[model samples]
Target chain A: MGQRPGDLSAPARLAGPDEGIGADELALATRNHGLPLEALRHDVTPPGLHYVLTHYDIPYVPDAGAWRLTVDGHVRTPLDLSLADLLSFPQVTTRVTLECAGNGRALLTPRPVSQPWLVEAVGTADWTGVPLRRLLAEAGADPAAVDVVFTGADHGVERGVEQDYQRALPLSVATGDDPQVLVATAMNGAPLPPQHGRPLRLIVPGWYGMAQVKWLRSVTVGDVPFTGFQQSVAYRIRRTPDEEGEPVTRIAPRALLVPPGFPDFMSRTRVVRPGPVRLSGRAWSGQAPVSSVEVSTDGGAHWEPAVLDPVVDGHRWAWRAWHHTWTATPGEHAVGTRASDADGHVQPLDQHWNRGGLANNAVCFVRVVCVADACWP
Target chain B: MGQRPGDLSAPARLAGPDEGIGADELALATRNHGLPLEALRHDVTPPGLHYVLTHYDIPYVPDAGAWRLTVDGHVRTPLDLSLADLLSFPQVTTRVTLECAGNGRALLTPRPVSQPWLVEAVGTADWTGVPLRRLLAEAGADPAAVDVVFTGADHGVERGVEQDYQRALPLSVATGDDPQVLVATAMNGAPLPPQHGRPLRLIVPGWYGMAQVKWLRSVTVGDVPFTGFQQSVAYRIRRTPDEEGEPVTRIAPRALLVPPGFPDFMSRTRVVRPGPVRLSGRAWSGQAPVSSVEVSTDGGAHWEPAVLDPVVDGHRWAWRAWHHTWTATPGEHAVGTRASDADGHVQPLDQHWNRGGLANNAVCFVRVVCVADACWP
Candidate 1:
């Protein structure tokens, strides 16, 4: 092969200073950016079907033989442990619904300048790991510690700032009796994929995914609150850079309609024979258990309560499945769903406007055509 | 659960006439938009890892019990065959590389306003299908037929045009003993996934993905070329509305550098050791087989020929792997690769600008940092 003159040099200009790379570069930086929204139409999301978001191209897979995790800082004892050591600790497995802080960012009016995630940036997974509280207790935390910071292996430049992936939580949330906060090593009963953060990752159940740092390398307990780039800069919900916006935490109540996905030739709606059409979906809340869910079939003009599955093990992080049976109809129709948590937070008709578009629980509606018969024109 | 005041009615406006839905709508309409660029770094893309581009939300999975494939139009005898009948025809399984016509559209200067794909919209798969020639012969295609039109089950409004997904090829290419032209029933040894087009889909080897209609319903031979919405309007390349631009077909020769995606703290380059590092990737062409591949280590100032894997067969639809080894010195470096086809069509330094941003075969480069010893700091 001989050198082609224009080929090699032209693309280099794209990386130059004058022409700043735009959304296209951000879109290309990760392998699997997000999952298709249709993926949410399923109750139990398959591991491969799960959505993925990363700070960088999937970080290198560390050699299992040499990997280590360190816990240090204001604690009485600084602990450095191998993967084997961590595994030996009492293991806990729990199902948790994780939503990215930027989940509904795309729907934000005047859209936030970020990953442009749609509704599919959320998923529920059965994570297996050691509890973070147990690990912190073993390290003997200092009383003066105010925040616990978790660091990941992935790093990149974003908004002209270079940093490794880092996020923090208050000491109270980190060391609580809730066994749901885990140092997850496996997802869906299998070892975490590299993109999902292999070997070790933090699972801050109920909070947005940003707190669940992947490829966990260190945990530091600090006397002062950790004001890391990811914590104070990127994920904050502020209109301007000067404002100290609220840190996004705890997902809002949201319910999705899992249609049967049958195709209809008229009006972009799924076609179903005139009979009982079973509509089902999964719903969850970060701060409380989902108390109930409601469905609307006439463009929100009418609504009905849906049956909710019994909660499993009083886990606040897990999502509850909801089902509603719509009786026979033979015309165009739209289906919408909403959920209310025990905390009295009902899914909103319209999302509260936030600059970052974080925690948008706006009700989602799907259109379907109820056909008289199952015959194609 | 009772209906909240604004919750039900608010979201109805999103599907309104004034404000057309944006990215969130587009993302929900397809199962897979494009492959993550990082996924292209792998040699044999896993079945699930393959990129998917569809006209609609994976059209409701067709009922296998009622599916049929009809062959008519300009044929001496029409044939409506069931799944079993088509499966009984001698199967021809072949590995083929499929690239979206809009593959590198995102990188175009003054970027095209489309799916915004950036280089990862290509993959190779082993497809098991009955040859189109066999099917056409069985139906007795008419001597006057000039084009063969393939129609898919998907239909929707794009660019204000409502129509079913359709495309066509000259009768010569359709029925010419090219075993590569397939009526694919399976991919990678399993039944095709709904997202990838279940039951049946057409595989026009070496052509851009648009020509490979999914959820194929019928193969119609016509006396004249087909002028459907997807064929005459959408996939064509033109700078102005008045110009009846040429239709995009056949994959172009392109090369990509598959770097070891290691993490580097200093720059966004892959981290490597201070010794020899081997870089490799795949290259392919539509008009001809990949003749050779070249690598550039110091930007584009120097180039060296890389070893290309022997062609597996005369099938020009598949890709060939290329590898290059470089003696490394500590520091950062950019790696680039380019390929030339047997037809003397070398990968372009810069892609020619197109209105729809189709047929982008520009060269690709990757960056890496060589560290001293194995220390990250």
Candidate 2:
């Protein structure tokens, strides 16, 4: 097989800011203050290290003492709900992974003209909030409403357009029976941080981060598809200005290798004896449960099925851990991992080229060296 | 000196796009429709090979027969001038090099989110047009005007902001005595191509390409600086979301090596005998003329002065050629080059990190192998 665009023979490093994820309580990744890949090693990412991708620089922190979320526009009964009112409704909690649409964008060829993300821009979090369907029902959303637009308080001019960060979902998805679609107020059993979303946020499970409007202020029911900047222009894949490609939506099937974090050069510290070396990582998909994961130790020439952890109910968006034990040799080697979902949506060896570089889920690899005389850890 | 972020020991190639510069009559460079670094080999770059960068996918092609440039807002005489009217006015021509602010961005560490550009996103061309100062003068621009906002016909939404491709210049720079600041209608003695701004374009000498509003439709004089999305937010370099860094404007001092383009593996077609090899390239700066250029054949450890070419009058933005001769060694070696401008602005061995990855002018190097028995070219 031909080498992928970003699969360099030597380890590749990006230039500019340092993106080291230190042992700090709150480790901040480099671009847009995102989470580091280290955070994904945990079955449930720590709240502090959960990737936070905000559109605006200053995330809006509503004064809980006076903040209100107004539900109107194409509603039979307009409603204004405060924090207390939102909390009064029955709450739903779910563990879901939110990946940036631009994840792995840096790996794209010809390169898109936006955030150049590697594969680290994703995190899974346990969110507690009221089901969005309940709020829409309480507000008596009009049957004719075709879409529900979620508007955030974060407003800024991007390109040349002045806009409040907004995105719309088809009414079917907005008012679906899926209890995972939430108007979230708390995360990891704590109130949302100002950087995440203070008073309220929209968490659309299985969708990319853009669909989960942070710092959410209002939910409006509209009779037509929202033609907001974020919906119609910014997020859609376009080969040219005139050609409108599909709008980015769900997360693609992906598997991430977590062991052997250090490269081969750091063999003095990371190398193991010529014995069995255990490898583990996580696999996920938006369309279905992770059905299987495969590991390759000879640069993908041979593959072996990995043992997957049992799936838990009610966490459809949660990733599944997979493990493999490899008998090591006393030399350098490349290891790779790939996953397939229950729907048979398998991770591609390489990502399909897109103008916006969205939805990249190419297989990931790590290089490791084994020391002949070293003892097992 | 330590290796810079992108100065890999081996010659590195950009991922995704095939940025090949064909050897046709025009020799158009691939990837963003830009000019290849090889085009800079000639003191006066061939018109056909000149680079073109367009924001929108479809370049706006105005009907020359009906196109009108409107000059209004804070102007004493609001005028709608046709192509003929623009042609009737006295014209000015100047050779200027235009570079994208994101040039060399791919080389930045941590990688800023935007076009992952290498160093090739720049070009020089002789532009013919009416001096913008003259046009503003004819319109009787108000003396109190603080900025001149140039608006292009191209419109699109970027990052959720809907904007006509627009940029603003401080009044002084917009109406300066510099004849290079033009309302360009022709490039390299030919009518501008649609992709190069067919009807009219603003040519702000020394500024990055963003300041050159292409497909010009209207010029608005304003009492306050234009706080357009591209100006106040998107282009600024920020360390954090809240701390606004300075807006990027002028091009930084930079020098690029031209010859020895292919790396060692391709030496069969490009290698020369183990003797003195002549090397040449171009240098330019927004603040001042390039004062000196240094070349290093053994990584960046040793450096020697290169012969600087004489500067031509009126082509202030044009890069000057620098030449060096290196005795060949029959082995692989890394060659590097850097430049210093007259204003004491020296090219840094490494780039200062910026969030937008703007204005990267780090020292660049190329890897080549000398053939032992080949005769000198």
Whole-model lDDT per candidate: 0.72, 0.69
Which tens-of-lDDT digit does each residue in B203-228 have in candidate 1? 88888899888999999999987888
- Of the true interface contacts, the fraction found in model 1 is 0.06
Winning model by DockQ: 1
lDDT of 2 by residue, A1-377 (tens): 22121221112122223222111101111213334343455666654345555554334243664778999999889889889999999998888888888787655665553444557677788889999989999989998889999999775434434468899999899988653589999887878766567778998888888999988889999998899978887788776667867998888888887645232110111334567888887888887788999999887888999999887675778888888999987666678899998888998886687666778888866655565532221
lDDT of 1 at B287: 70
DockQ of all candidates, in order? 0.10, 0.01
Q: Which tens-of-lDDT digit does each residue in A8-107 have in candidate 1?
A: 1122111222222233333532244555445555544555456667766556564754778899999988999888898899999888888877776655
On TM-score, the leading prediction is 1
lDDT of 2 by residue, B1-377 (tens): 22121221112122223222111100111113334444566665544344444444324243676888999999999989998999999998888888888777656666553444557677788888999888899999998899999899765434434457788988898899752579999987878765567778888888888888888999999999888978887678776666767989888898887646231110111233467888888888887878999999887888899999888784677888889988876666677788898889988887887777788788877655565432221
True contacts kept of each: 0.06, 0.00
- Candidate 2 ranges beyond 4 A from true positions: A1-34, A60-62, A261-273, A373-377, B1-377
Q: Say which candidate scores most in lDDT.
A: 1
